[model samples]
Target chain A: MNRRQSKVLRTLARLVIRLWQMRRVLLLVVPYLFLFGWLFAAGSRMDVRPGELYGVTDEPAWGSPDADHWFGTTVNGADLFELSRLAMATSVSVAVVSVSFGIALALLVTMLFVFDPGEKRFELPNVVGQSGFLLPSFVVLLVLTGGSGGSLGVAILGLILVIAFHLCPVLTTWFQEGEDGFDIVAGYALGLSRREIVMNRILPKILRRLVGVFATYVPVVVLVEMALSFLGFTGDRLSCGAMIAYGQGLIIEAPWMAIYPGLMATAVVLVLSLLGWRVSSAMRTGPLPRLF
Target chain B: MARIVLQRLLVSVIRFAAAGLALIVLIELAFCVIGGSDRHVWRAESYGPVPPGLSARPVSWAGLLEDRVRVSLPVLFICVPGILLIGYSWGILGARLRRFHGARLLAAPFSLFACVPGFWFVVLVAIYSYFHWKRPGFADDLIVEQGPDLLTWWHAAVVALPALAAGAASQIRAVSSVLEREVTRPYLRGLFMAGYSEEDIFYRHAFRRALPALFAAGDRTFSALAGSIVCLEYAFRYPGIGSLLVEAVRLGSYGGILVSAFVLAAFVSAGVIFCESASRLIKPEAAGG
Candidate 1:
């Protein structure tokens, strides 16, 4: 083969080898993907009415798992399986939005800090920002969203903002460490502007590290969102946490109602966590150390 | 020595002042944004109960601060002992358990336990206890109602166990890694060849080297505990700073939220400083390393 074809073949081989190495994680994640797909496809076909299943006077309460109600029925007469699907969808959506917003804001703030290192001298903001995470996130959400009376969209936005704010200090610390290790003197010698060096050289070099950090943090955001939803702070949203909370009272009579949702939530977190662990481990074996 | 202590104290005081100011500014900013008003008005209003025209901001601030301080005392009482108990026991137990077969078998579930949310455990226990209390011929003495009281040590222990398990899992991993690294060092082989007993080498020499990492793990575990304390306190409906902050937030009480934030920050800072100091006392050379 010619040189270009040979190089392309080599790259494709490397990709295949890498994918083979990640087969275990991929296998672990397949069930979640299948569940998500099934939920998506079956969601529209399933009746959306809660009263049709359980709210009626004659309807059985705390039904066991069966063909009619696969996951069982909640004490409040809601279908556990359907509620779990909805909750999982809502939670995954919130987690995606929150993590995305957090990472984006972290990148922006990290870039800002890189351009102006003057803020480093004032450690107060870092401390204060960290305290945001230390404080109960539900409180922050409640305060920001004005006692959770807002729409689901607004609640999600509030969660995104708070999570992003909490993650800023952590991301900034990682990014700062990366910048510190960069050859800034050499960049200057190369006659690159500050923005050019940061955008092109520093950022590109640290992109994998940022991804590792982002993966490590996604599980945290998911847990935080779950906690907030469990506390009824997410404002009437159907979340795994809310499902678990609602099922807590009937845990003895109908344990499936709680266990299924808990397992689903745990599955999501475990998958994201393993993905993070894989990414971080790969980065560790690669050129960079694990940022998180 | 006295000068060093004085300097450290001074630095801590300054740090606390800065943190307090930063917390106030953050609260003011939050209030302004949420209330959709001018920053200056929020700033003045946050100083508290001053009727907007009073020159004595300090007095009102101090009075408000005292109330918050009072509110935070119980949180400190509950969280301090709870964290210390969980951190020390779990850290030491986890490290020691890494050697045992039975404990090794638990490694997977313990690691998975770290992934589970603390509130889920709390709810499950609550439900279990409720059923147990309702059991026929169950003793009245066994039916202890878990509440948000300061004396509810058992309640704290139960609620804190999941966080503790999570912390212990990470601690076990950290300790094992450190031990693995230590085992591969040349000095370990040298000690083995020098006629030192295996237990002596592992427990005396290697353990000393592992202490710093173990302490660092403990620090991380404490921080995790602090994070989980918020959820635990809230889930158990504990009257700690966490639940108070939640209540304040729900009521849109800016001053209460600010005060709780400040207290929580101070508590964390103090815990970190204390951990550093203890670590230094244990291994002075490993303070910053």
Candidate 2:
């Protein structure tokens, strides 16, 4: 083949690899982006008074489904449809942001186990991981939110800490396992320090594990958020959880209030889980790449 | 002799701790159920609609748990015992079912059945049963509407035990593998070749060697099951301490929330203590200091 032909073939190969690696993440994230867009659009047309959405008033209770009001009115006179959208956005954002923060926290913790003894101070996070796993995230979110001021930031921050701590243990274990490779020991033998060995040798072994970890965890993170929101811990504005809470009141009246958001949450979680399974399988079965 | 005594004492302490923590959690759940909701309190005028065959009594904590346990217990009994007995019997069954080749297919169903989040599975099963077995006059009629109540810890235990049993069994496989690998090491091989019989090699040598890691692995398995239960409880509306704790926060029930947290903390602290004690038992020489 000519040089041009070889170059095009190489480009196509690279694209295929990148696409395959990205497929799971794209599948999981696209629905979220769509839901979020709808939520933002719904919020822009917010007709309900602010406090009314939080259950301080009964305006949401009075609105009826119509051309103007897509979702019937709540007892508080807010548009149920509008409120649903807002809740979707709030809930998704909380889950996604908290999960992102959690993955970052896990990465940092993994680095400590793999490299940099100086970063070992964060071992407290791993101990927290033990308790964090057994105690439901919603329960922890509740305590953290209930104890702190019920500000959105406060709740999110508290949740982030709970999630971060929970993730660190698993991350630490993965890194620790990868750290046991022959390359790492060889690097140590070649006069490289522990830190150098981890950075240069162990990181490659763990790259795939890290992908598996992140992919597997996204669904779990979303479920935690849904539970929290369902309990009304995620900031009160039409969160997925808040909608369900509202639906609890309206089960006899407008069962859609609960069913819609419940279905949405369930769908999102299931998709992410399936995608995670696919990604992990791909990572495990793929041909071993040449070490540079 | 001192090491044996210490080991016995440690085991006793852990058993006490687990039982005590489980008890405290039960009491907290009772309080939350009875005192939980003051919202929209109105009497149920009559039985509106309940699934046929299932009787709906006045919403009482004791009744709710008893009812749930009654409904869930049969399934749990069938699944748990069936899975364990069948899983262990697979190799035996293979000889008989050689034409059917059922053993290979058996593990996945058992594992999936075992792995299913009990809350979701129970809810799905309950709904399915409700639809399938509908009988006349079974519908619950008028009742007082109140905020959700907590599910008893006994109920949680009953619902959780089957899953836990299945999980514990799976962990046994993993724990034994670790034990088998560690016991076959060179130093241990030398000891075994010289004098130790196979039984002594397993009990005295392997058990002692693998107990620490097995305990740690036990913790991992327990936590994974517990995590699954959180969502499961929430889904089934089983007001176990885990879910009550979630609801308490939602309702701004600070006292209830605090009590639940304390109970959870105790359970966790006890688990850690158990793991530590077991580790010490396995490596008495290391713990001597």
Candidate 3:
């Protein structure tokens, strides 16, 4: 088929698959949405005025539960429910950005490792980039958070870089595995250039692994971001981890402060893990042939 | 045959124990130099004057060991047994056991982290024991005092080391199982039936077959540990090399940064050594003279 025709067919196939998967995920999401909505509507209104946190202790806004604040009021008296929503959105964005960058970097690096194993010059640069893996993200985040910008983009970029660095090995391995089929060897034997072979052939197989990897890493992304935010490295106003750390001191007066956010974060992670498993299962042609 | 099997088992245990002990000592020494003092012994002794012998020792090895035993024993005794029981139960339940190749590999380290919940359980027991043993009217408050810097770093190392060791042990088991599966494939079976067995089959045939991929797996495991360790250390406030590195970051302490970098580099080097050693065992011919 011509390039245009192939692209159209690919788009159609992807749309069908996405819609089918979305239906399942949406089924799972509906109950969560209902729970969140009911809780927010039924919960007390928060006074999370701009530049104000909940309680007197500079804790997060979800620090107390009462008739005035069902989820409880933070030390600053901000509604716990609303702040939970914001934390949820921030976490979802972090998960998306981190997983996207991680998968992309993994694909690129793995392709480099697979088709061009001994070409040291290019791979050397890749290794140097990977040396950043050992540098704790907190250090970089501290340096960055110390700077002026606290934009959402900066936080996303930070989270993505951390997740991507962690993902390098997995991406590389999956790429190597998917690239090792008879077709790839045949392509090389037939004198297809490395770029042509990787782009036209290896990538298709690698793409199959993307759903699985993306599903797997999303939960980890959420956890790492929570950690980063907890460490005060996120630079944003609030994060799931930051909320947990900040709210712990008020665990007694406002148990909901910890309970609500912690439950949200945990649920999101569990969902991502289950989704990852589903994606892996869905991609199965059969029992996977072992690769040596 | 039984005697030979027993000998190999003894050798492997000795080797594993030696590596584990060497790791503990080396990490403690590194924490000592970083913490910059050595007054405490057995626990953080903030109120006391320094003993002359401890001050004069090569690396505060005894103080470090006491701290390690004090902190680590409770945590490990609780976590190791608990996880073994849970993992054992899961193993029994069959389907509930993680079967995904990647998930299984990830879980070894993840479960090690997950076992931190066991620390709280340990602390409760310790508190109960203290009361049971006739409390000397100790402070039972949750907010434990942070005392002198003397060997706080060592104490952190001692606290962190067991978890790291456990994490490494699980990863090795997971990766080796994956490697074994990879090496014992049908194609490898073909090479085996072609008049190879045992050493020849593993080294000459299987090892050659799996080298690139094994390195690939090593890279992945190493990277995953890198991300997880920092969070784990920070959560426990374990003043390991990673935690020191993080504090250096938070305070922008350049000395802490250097130490952290040096220690992290050492770990990466150790990982490389681990890979090389594993390769040698799997395929001796690969390191052919």
Candidate 4:
């Protein structure tokens, strides 16, 4: 082959190595996303939103698990498989948006109020923001949402806002802990510029810590959405928690109804948690006992 | 020193109040915008599906107050001492026994599950309690109901368990780290050179230095417990402040939500100010203040 062709083949080899190196993370994340997409498409066709289909008690109700009805049937004869998928999709989708916005807002709060870049010292965060440290996201959301009835749009917006404020004190404290008390003084004494010192000497130390924050916060936010749903504040009535609430009652009669979805929910949380621990331990300050 | 502390306390209180009052004002503004307009010159004409104005209802709910006093207060009281005793002892021990694998072993859960979903404990406890001991349906209050007076305190312990579990985990980590840093500081070496005893150096100097950190941890734990109570009450369908808020939101009762929000906001504001000032007072700089 010509030099250009050889170079192209070499690039393909490198690409294969890169994918091979990241296979562990991809093995977990891709299937969940693909399944989410498939379930979302299926839900769109079925046109089954949680609250809209909540009171759906029709014929062939409470059918047991079989070939056609994979998981089972709800009281309304709606496929439990579809229900679980839609719920998972709803919870994960909302959590994704909420965590992204929340983290970004938290970073801004830290930069603007908590960390005084001008003085290079920490300042107390807003008092109301401190209130978030005292209160959970759901309490604040309940207070703020008032009577929105947990519509999809309202739930997403409310979750984002709630999570953002709830994270302020947490992020601030983490940043504070990340700062070694003597670092700034030592850096300045060395004749380094503020920007140079921050970029070269400081930000790297804290950036890994931020990765730990992201790992832990995502699952927590997903759980937040689920908790809200558990409290009967389901948007569209489609959440993994709401499904569990409905199925849990029929545990003896139709165990599969709750069991399958419950397992799926557990699996999602478990996988995320393990992934978080693995990633954070690898990047965090302390030594880990072993390789995961 | 007393005068300085008092002055500093007053300033901190004002700052906290400003933050809280700002939120309260924002809530009122939100009410005006989203509450649908019906201002009758000086007063709102009717309360409608939602309440009319901020002054339309009394700020206190008897049930809310009872819940706060009976349920949440006991939990808070229990948690404060439990966290301090457990956090301090574990941390001081962890620092002294830094070479012991068991110290790290004990703290494993905190780092591993620090970010786990908050409600898992509540849910799991409710489920296990239900399956193990057949009580009320739907895990409502798990095993407790509006029974005898003693059971109320029992229920309080049950409710506090989740927060305590998570809080202790975090506290252990925070305490150990702080103590580790303090134990290694040069000042401790100076004390060592001065021929001070180990326990004296630890309790007097190292522990004093770590007190500010302990206060901050307590503040964070208090917040976590408070937040957890809301979720727990809602999950249990208990007649407490959390369920009250959930009910208010469900029914779209502006009076209920607003008044409850105001009271809780005040509590949060006062608690934060006290914790912060208390922390500052312990700091060496408070002398200059």
TM-scores vs. true structure, each candidate: 0.69, 0.57, 0.59, 0.73
What are the DockQ scores of the candidates, in order?
0.24, 0.11, 0.12, 0.23
Model 3 lDDT tens row, B74-127: 433443344344432332222122245443544545443432321222222233
**Per-model TM-score (chain A alone):** 0.72, 0.69, 0.66, 0.76
**Candidate that would win on DockQ:** 1
Model 3 segments more than 4 A misplaced: A1-51, A57-70, A76-78, A105-122, A129-152, A166-179, A188-195, A252-255, A284-292, B1-184, B187-229, B232-243, B281-289
Model 2 alpha-carbon miss at residue B253, Å: 6.1
Who wins the lDDT comparison? 4
Q: Candidate 4, what DockQ?
A: 0.23
Sorted by DockQ (best first), the order is 1, 4, 3, 2
Tens digits of per-residue lDDT, candidate 1, B121-201, equal 776666666667663211112434585443345565655577666656665555555565565678879988999987777
Residue by residue across A4-104, what tens digits does model 1's lDDT show? 56888999999999987767556545654775586565353323432333232444467788888777776555667767767666666667677678678
| Residue B164, model 4, lDDT | 65
Residue B216 displacement (Å), model 4: 2.1
**DockQ agreement of candidate 3 with the native complex:** 0.12
- Candidate 4 chain A: 10-residue stretch with minimal lDDT: A51-60
Write model 2 residue lDDT over A1-292, tens digit each, in one string.
Answer: 6555588899999999997776665665576567556656765432333335435343345544578765566665656665666655555566667767876776776565555456464466564454344453444555555434244675667557666766677667666656666776677678888766666666665666666666666665555565555545445454555566555544444545545555555555555555565565456536433220
Q: Can you tell me which runs of candidate 1 are displaced by over 4 Å? A: A1-62, A74-78, A115-142, A146-202, A248-260, A287-292, B1-32, B35-110, B135-151, B169-224, B254-259, B279-289
The C-alpha lDDT values of all candidates are 0.59, 0.51, 0.50, 0.60
